[model samples]
Target: MNFANACRLTLLAAIWGASFLFLRLAVPSLGPIWTISARIGLAAVFLALVAQALKQGFAWQHWREYLILGIFNTALPFLAYGFAARTLNASMMSILNATAPIWGAVIMALIIRKMPTFKVCLGLLIGILGVAILVGFDRVVSQTGAALGIATCLSATLCYGIASAYTKLKASHIPSFQVAHGSMWGASLFLLPLFATSQPISTPTPVVWLAIAGLAILCTGAAYLLYFRLVREIGAASTLTVTFLIPVFGILWGTLFLGEHIGSNTLIGALIILLGTALVTGFNPLASRK
Candidate 1:
């Protein structure tokens, strides 16, 4: 927890937090498929240039691995969250996204054939409770995007969590930068046909291009670099803490820039979700051993 890593944490939080806002802006102009495609495409190009400059030529040794990561981590989750955000508020979407660690823990347990630590199991239960509290009552009491939007957010997180477990396993042998670059390029390729069908360029604007640029340079490129650095400096648990702060800035930007409303339920849900994340990432049954 050095001062420098702390600052990096804050920077990563702000950058990712603002990602939802960028999506919101770009989606209106370009639609979800195109907006996401543009970002991943641009990010791939930028990362490729950087890698070449650093003498890291494109490595296709694990093209299959990168392709899977791209599909799960980049394409599927991005589209799910993007479409979901059209209906769900930023705060709510972020709250749901925070459940990634819980999903990760569960996936790990399943894949590794080892019992999750007690604390991890408990954290999973608590996280589920929080999601229920957030979405259950809303679904029962209202018809305002409670089902579709919430489902999208949770599904997106599920993809993220599964991808995370896979990344942890595969990235053990792959160069981290190559992983990032390959994932971006694979995502771009996956989205290309969809982008072609939608064809956002048919009705483009300068603002839309700017949104794509921000998504590419800031959210995708810069964010991934800091993400890796933060993981190294703070460990995965602390690095993922950025997820908690992302929603705060996302909600703020949504309200300030997009004029989106912040509902009372959304705020309550956010608090509960943060509590769940804290439990999942910070808790350890074996803490006494340390």
Candidate 2:
């Protein structure tokens, strides 16, 4: 990869990684439903403007598909993470995000009615072990609602896995940008009623508004654009390297900005999870270089 693409990859990771921090900052005041609603709502607006600027129009006929994708891919997972952010540290949530591919492999295997390969099975086991270590040993476990938060985050990753499998099964023909843009709109609509019915626990201060903007614009909207560009230029596998990089930035941002402590379990669990992910995806850095 060229130095510029490499930098883009790192920047993408950093932006996405910082999403957890934004969630942690924003969710307390806005609450999960409102936080995620505003996030998808604002991101939809941003992507709409970008789509217009690029003269790309939506395929309105595919609104049903977009709704399904939006619920599974955007709305559910974002809501789950937003809920979890209230109880879990940004670092922990980021590490848990890495489990999406593992869940994807399992979902795919079940969908095809075939067993996973030995490597994948082993990776799945190792990944579970890593999550156990991370959650069981972490200091957060003692906090109220932490267990539920962990479960919520895991459910979020499971939603991502379901979305991936669903895309491959039903929506592969749709362009990536269209899927992203349409889904944000879909998610916004999905969450609109929920946001309307629910009230924020506290009024949002300016900093909270800033956090919401960062989450919506930088982390969700711009990050998707950057991710798709990397996919086009470097192929999906190399672009996926961003997955491994995300948790590193997640932990760093949590530590540096939020003053969240990273115990040894965090490091050990993250490494194990990434190793399991590498095995499951068969992602090799050396192969990408060629």
Candidate 3:
């Protein structure tokens, strides 16, 4: 990778990593519906303006497709994760979110009616073990949260898995920016009724307001731009290494900003989870030794 892409990787990872912290801070003040609504709403407007300026605006040729994609990709996941953020800390949520790729593999296998390679099967097992470790020691034993929080976080990742596979099958031809723009708008519109009925605007402290704005603009908007740009520069496969780095910064930001505790179990489980993820994604270090 070039130096520029390296910087992109670092910045992208930091931006996304900080998302968990932002959600943790904002969710309490805005609540899930308003928080996610404002996030997707703001991101959509920002992306739309940029697209119009560049004359590369989203083509609404597939509104239905965008609607479905937005539901899975943005609306549902953000809502579920927002709710989970109330109970789960930034580090825990980030770690669980990494399970999205594993869920994607499971979803694909079911769709194709074929099992993964035995190596990938092993990776899946290790990933499950990692989750068990986190649940058993990090939260369940410590009583930081109950099963509901963990379940919601995992469910958010399930939405991610479904959205990813759906996008690949249905909307691969669309530019990434267009896809993000259309999906954000679709999600914002989809949540409008809920936002109106259930979401009351509350006065948060200026710090919380900053958190909400940062969550919307920086985490959602700029993060997407960085992600798509990296995909363009480095190819998608290499760009995915950002996944491994995300949790690192997630833990860091949580520790530094939120003053969240990072237990030994958190570190160990995260390492195991990333190892399994690497295997699932076709990383084979042992092969190099041979």
Candidate 4:
């Protein structure tokens, strides 16, 4: 990656990292349905404005792909995260989020009916180890709601994995902006009934509203711009490294803003997870052997 792209990558990681913090603040108040629905809904509106400013237009035929992505990628995953945020700290949530690529590999293996490379198999195992270390250290298994929260977080990442594979298999031809915009709308649609039934809307404090704005506008909408730009400028493989850095900033943001614990075990587990993901995606130069 060039210096500019490197900068963009770092910014993208920071934005995504902050997303966990936003969820930590907003989800409990808004409830999963309203919180996640507002997030994608507002982000879709922002992206639409930007698209109009850029004189860009997309075809309506991509509705089917939008629905698929909306369900697996946006609606389901965001719903899971909303449930998880009630108990999981921002740092812990980010660590679990790193498992998406590992899940993606497993999904790909199942879809293809073939074994993954040795490195990939090793990565998958280490990724599991990373999760074990975290859950063990946190004693999430023993906690009441925390265990279920962790499970929801894992399910959320699994949804992300499914979305990635589905995108590659069926919708790779669609433009990133279209998929992002349409999928957000799709997710909003999916969450509409849930939003109505889950909770009555209440006036949020100013702080909560700020968190909502950041979550929807900055974390989701603006982050997509940086991500898509990096994918176009650098190869997607290079852009993928941002995933490793996201947890780093996630921990940092949690500590600085929310005063969440950033224990040694959190750092160690997150490092292992990122390392395993690097191996899975061929991000490790030292492990590149014939």
| lDDT assessment of candidate 3 | 0.84
Return the top candidate by lDDT. 2
Ranking by lDDT: 2, 4, 3, 1
Instruction: Note the Cα lDDT for every prediction shown.
Output: 0.79, 0.94, 0.84, 0.86
Clashes of 1: 0
List the RMSD of every prediction in angstroms.
3.2, 0.8, 2.5, 2.3
Q: Please tell me which model should have the higher TM-score, number 1 or number 3.
A: 3
lDDT of 1 by residue, 1-120 (tens): 778887888788877878887776777667788888878989999998888888888888888988999999999999987787666666567668788877877888899999977767
Q: What stretches of model 1 exceed 4 Å from their correct place? A: 136-146, 283-290
lDDT (Cα, tens digit) per residue for candidate 2, span 55-154: 9999998898899999999999999999999999999999999999999999999999999999999999899999999998999999999999999999
Candidate 1: the clashing residue pairs are none
Cα shift from native, residue 289, model 1 (Å)? 19
Tens-digit per-residue lDDT, 1-290, candidate 4:
55777788889999999999998888767777788888888998999999899888966899999988999998999889888888888899988999998898889989999999999999988888888888788744465799889999999999999999999999999999889888888888888888777772466777777888999999999998888888887767777787888888998999999988666777788888888887787785433211
TM-score of each: 0.89, 0.99, 0.94, 0.95
- Give the TM-score comparing model 3 with the true structure, all chains together: 0.94
What is candidate 3's CA lDDT for residue 106? 81
lDDT of 2: 0.94
